[model samples]
Target chain A: MAASSRRDGGAAGRAKAERSAWVLLTPMCLLMAVAFILPVGLFLLYSFYRFRGGRLEETFTLETYWRFMTDELYLITIYDTLQLAVLATLLCLVISYPLAYAMWRMRSPGLQKLIAFIVFAPVLVSVVVRSYGWTVVLADQGPVNFILTRLGLTSGPVSLVYNMTGTVISLAHVFLPFVVFPILASMLRLDPTLREAAEDLGASWWKTFRSITLPLTLPGVVAGAQICFTLSLGSFVTPAILGGGRVLVLPIQIYTATSDINWPVAAVGGLCLLVMAFIAVVAFGRLSQYSEAV
Target chain B: MAARIARAGRLPAWRHLALGIFTVAAVVFILAPLVIVILTSFSAQSYAIFPPEGYSLRWYANLAAQTTFYVAALRSLILALVATAASLVIGTMTAYALVRYRPRGHSALKAIFLSPVVLPKMVLGVAVFMLVIKIGFYGSSWNLVLTHTLICVPFVIAIVAASLANFDWSLQEAALDLGSKPLPTFLKVILPQISVSVFISGLLAFVTSFDQVETTMFLMRPGESTLPIEMFLYLQRWQDPTIAALSSVLIVFAIFLLVMTSLVLGRRKITTLQTSAEPQP
Candidate 1:
């Protein structure tokens, strides 16, 4: 009888706990449903709706997607978006790996902390401000151009800003801290003894790094790359400010379409970005798993 | 062992020199724009010219004269504070429930909660804009506050849950056994222990909300822009050094935040990156 009562008490406690859990979760669920899920669903629905003469018709159709697939304009926009993300992510990785490796290999704690702090400092500032700063820094007669001219690398100032080059450079700068921290985290979590063992085995530093450290930290690289790609894919501000109307990516298209009240076009363009971001996330997830397995 | 290897100079001296040079170059690349902005703010020229022919505080004076930025800065500040507070409260409850109760489908539920972090903010912005338009809640400040909260709550939940994962349940149990209620038990026994995490999360959430441009852009009504939006629109119209001055002030604010975060984080500075730095054992 006593054991049975104890079991009954346990069941009652669990029931109460479940009730409390639901209560705590109620606000978040409501917020997501009302704000996030509902809105995204509406976006999906709008993609199927037709926009006739700047008016949104509630009837469902796949006209927008068909147009997106067939139109060279949209096809180019999608291609450019992917290209921008790819280039920015590549730039981030190229810069971050060496920087993270240096941070990991540093013997001085003070210098390491300073470097980490410096890398992270930009993240705190607004992207708009940073993009604007880049424009000035890379402008004609700006420091970069001034230096290049002085060095006789170019007889004339280069048109760096107001172009795809500026957009990619600024995007890479904006996402640099995000990429570096992940790689650095993985390096910090690395097993030191493994490296010592490799060294004792008379393995060269490069060989040990290639055989072990690189593979182990590949997951971090993948994770960082995922962040950079997704952020670049959705980045509207830096590209808007730095792209100088010359680089027309999907986000810019969506913004223009939305402003024009062309809901179908906006929805279609947004869906493309979502699909791209999702693909990158999945691809990176696979790479991270593969790296771990190896 | 790793430090010992580095100290014993297992690598060639040239490699160290190369790494040192690369690090310096990377730092320059990272800081060039920011430093240049501060320098340009003091430029005497009407247009931005590097290594200015002369220096003056004219731009700072011009920035002070622009009242639009002042209003927008105030709006951004209040909005960020409200969003941060709301997210902290809602997120703490959610984290506590998941950690303490171990509810069914806990991992799945957690994933759903964090899904917003991965969802493009631009999409979220457009989606929320459509919803508000549908519900006729367009032009409401609550819309911005709620959307910002949605974006920030994930960071709060992630950090608070991580902190709570390490919390001693014995204290809460003891408090309950002593006839204390759940809310009071949490307040007295749990909150103090996780206060640091809570503060860090709040700080981070504030920054995230304050820096929001992609998400807040569509929701804002005409002439009621946030600070970043105002700056963005202003840049679209002009490329003068007045913006450089405002950006300098913001850069100073960022430095202050960096210092505050470092002081709070102390030795476990890794926690600042804990949102993504969940080191697998």
Candidate 2:
């Protein structure tokens, strides 16, 4: 009888705990439902409505999707968005890997900490400020152009700003910290013995890094790439400030469509960005899983 | 280990030299834009040029003469503070429950809560804009507050949950057994333990909210823009050094935050070491 009663008491306590948990979670759930889920749902729904004759029409149709599928301009924008995202992600990986490796291999803790701070301090500044800075640095007669001219790399100031080059450079800079920390963390988490073992087996430094370090850190690389790709796909401020109205990425297109009061086009453009980000996320998730298994 | 590696001579000296040079170049690349902005802010010319021909504080004076930035800054400050306070309270409760109870479908619920992190800010901006307009709540500060809180709460939940997962619940039980009320016990015992995480998360939430532009862009009424939105628009229209001046001020603010965070974290580390040295009960 005593044992049965104790079990019953345990069950009752668990039930009470569950009830309290629900009580605690209620506000957040309500907020998410009303503020996040509902808005996103409405956004998706807006994609089906029609926009014609310079106004939004309250009707259900696939006209927006059809246009996106068939229109050459929209197609080019989609292609450009993907291209930019891929290029920026690749650039970030290339730059961040060597830097992260250097940081990880550093012997001095103080130096490592200072380097980390330098890498991360940019996050606190506004993206607008950073993009504006890039505009100046990449502009004609700017520092980069001045260097090129002084070195006789170019006869005149090359057009770097107001184009894809400027956009990619700035995006890569913005996403650098995001890329570095993940790779650095993975490098730190690696079993130090693996490198030592490879070295003991008379492996060259390059060979050991290739066989041991690189393989283990592939997951971090993929994770960082995932973040950079998604962020670049949806980037607005960098492209807007640096693109000089020449870069026609999806986010910029959406912004234009919305300001033109073309809700359907805006919705469709946003959906394209969303779908692309989702695909990248899933692909990287699979890659990370495979890397872990290896 | 590095010494051993050096002795082994498997790696060529040139390789190290190459890496060191590349690292310095990369750091320069990272810092160049920021340095340029600060330098341009001091330029006498209106246009941004390399190696400014002359220097003056004209842009700083121009920035001070503008009333719009001050108003926008004040608005951003209030909104961020309110949003941070609300998210911290709500997020702490959610994280506590998720960590302690391990209720059914907890992972699913947690993921749903954190889903906003993956959603693009521009998309969220349009989506919430649509909702607010439809509901006739356009231009309301409450709309901005609620939306900012939504974006910030996920970060708070993630940070607070990580800290709470490491919490020793025994102290809470002991407090309860001593006939202390649950709220008071939580305040005295639980909060002190996780205060660092709370403080860090709160700071992060404030920064995220304050620096928000894409989402705040659509939600804000015309002429009532946040500081970032104002700067963004101003940059779009002009390339003068006045924006650079404002940016320098923001950079100084960011540096202040960095210093404050380091101090707090440094103190926390020392306290943790001291606690570890204390005799157990």
Candidate 3:
């Protein structure tokens, strides 16, 4: 009986220890609740508020949703937003494919490291600085246009900034590292045996790439594209700086609404951006599944 | 067969040249604006002219002479430090609980913690600003610090959790069995192994907090700004050589960061530095 009582005491001690462990976890749980979960929750709720006469009504309504659905201006913002994200992702993919391929092909780890470093170095610098740098490069008298004019590629320096071209180019450049790493990860995971088998079967290099390499690495490409799209969708600083006020993406719209103190409109714009980003995430998930299943 | 061989040989050569040029041009393109800013800083006159009429360092001297930038710099640094400390505490605790406590709903908890990674900072800024105003907690440095910590926690949790995953739990078990207190066991055994991740995440947290502009923009009471905000305001007001001088300083700051990164990560694998901290399984 005494031995059985001691055994019960042992179980009780174990339970007590775990209870203390739960106690230790309290700070973290509290923080996430207050800081992360609460802010986002409170933030999202403003979307349902009415902003009549520049004053936000505390009462909840779906009028903002209706406005978002019915308003042509909001619809145009959505269209422009998707177009920007898609173009940015496509450009990033085109740039990253060769870059990642070269990194993967090199046998020397040292060379790989150096190339990777160069690609990622810009991320350490401020995005504002990088964007500012592009404004100079894309300016009419900037080095890019200067070189083009001297080389007779253009009659004069064409307008780059305050338009879609500069925005896409810089956005792609800014996101190049994000895209490259995912694709490179996928490429590195490719089985060398498959390529060798293709070559042995009398397939040419291009044929091997098309049949074996491309399809195998398609998952990574999709993932990289997904990241680029979502990031570009939420990107505010780059478009603001390079777009020179011509670009009217959702983030900028949200910012303007906030500045104008129209919480309902800003909230609605933010929700729309959030929804688009959510869609991109969902689409990316589907693409990954399809790629893997294929 | 001869035609096929010729086509194959020529194609690789062309592709190689094309790829090489593309690579070089892209790097140059990425670095060009920064280079131009450096050059413009040395201009004798007060305009953004490339290949300046003559070279001088007057703007840089003027940059050194600005007091507001100094204050803003200090504020940014302090705010980042406070936020980093806050995140490390919360993230470390959360990572421990999520990993070690055998908790139900771990995944949901993690998703909540990490949601800000995809959350637009501008939206959060607007929302928080409104909420704070609504709650009558408007325009305090505490508000900025708290909001910034929320954004910064996900990065810390990610890195620290990964490092913890790599840690040998048996050692932790051994310590616990040998009658070490849980906190001390974590401190003496687990933390040392995961210190590298903690340090990296801390640096990242510092940088993210310091470099924030858009989120902090609305939060800044007029004339009280972070360095990036200050630089942004200065840029908006004037595009003169003085701004170039300030940018050159920022370029130096970038170089300083690079050197610091190498010193910290030189012994570590290149792949680890390039990769974002892996999500904890």
DockQ of the candidate models in sequence = 0.58, 0.44, 0.43
User: Top model by TM-score, which number?
Assistant: 1
For candidate 1, the TM-score of chain A alone relative to the native chain A: 0.95
> Stretches of candidate 2 above 4 Å error?
A1-9, B1-10, B267-281
Higher-ranked by DockQ: 1 or 2? 1
Q: Could you arrange the candidates by TM-score from highest to lowest? A: 1, 2, 3
List pairs with backbone clashes in candidate 2. none
Question: Per-residue lDDT for B1-281 in model 2, tens only?
Answer: 67586645766778778888878988998888888999999999999989799999999999999999999999999999999999999999999999887678988888888878778788889899999988898998888988899988987898788788888787877787799997899899999999888887788789889999888988888999999999999987888999999999999999998898778777343212111110110
Local accuracy by lDDT, each model: 0.88, 0.86, 0.78
- The TM-score, computed over Cα atoms with residue i paired to residue i, of candidate 2 is 0.94
Worst 10 residues of 2 chain A by lDDT: A1-10
Candidate 2 Cα RMSD after full superposition onto the native fold (Å): 4.8
Q: List the residue pairs that clash in candidate 3.
A: none
DockQ of 3: 0.43
Alpha-carbon RMSD, each predicted model: 3.0, 4.8, 4.7
What residue runs in model 1 are displaced by over 4 Å at the alpha carbon?
A: A1-9, B1-10, B269-281
Global local distance difference test of model 3 = 0.78
> Residue-wise lDDT of candidate 3 within B1-281, one digit each (tens)?
67546644545576667767877766686677778878877889776544468998899889889999999989998999999999888888888776665356666877767777777788778877877777888778887988789778888888776666656677876787799997899899988888767877887788789888778888889999998888777766776777777767777887787778768677676556534622311
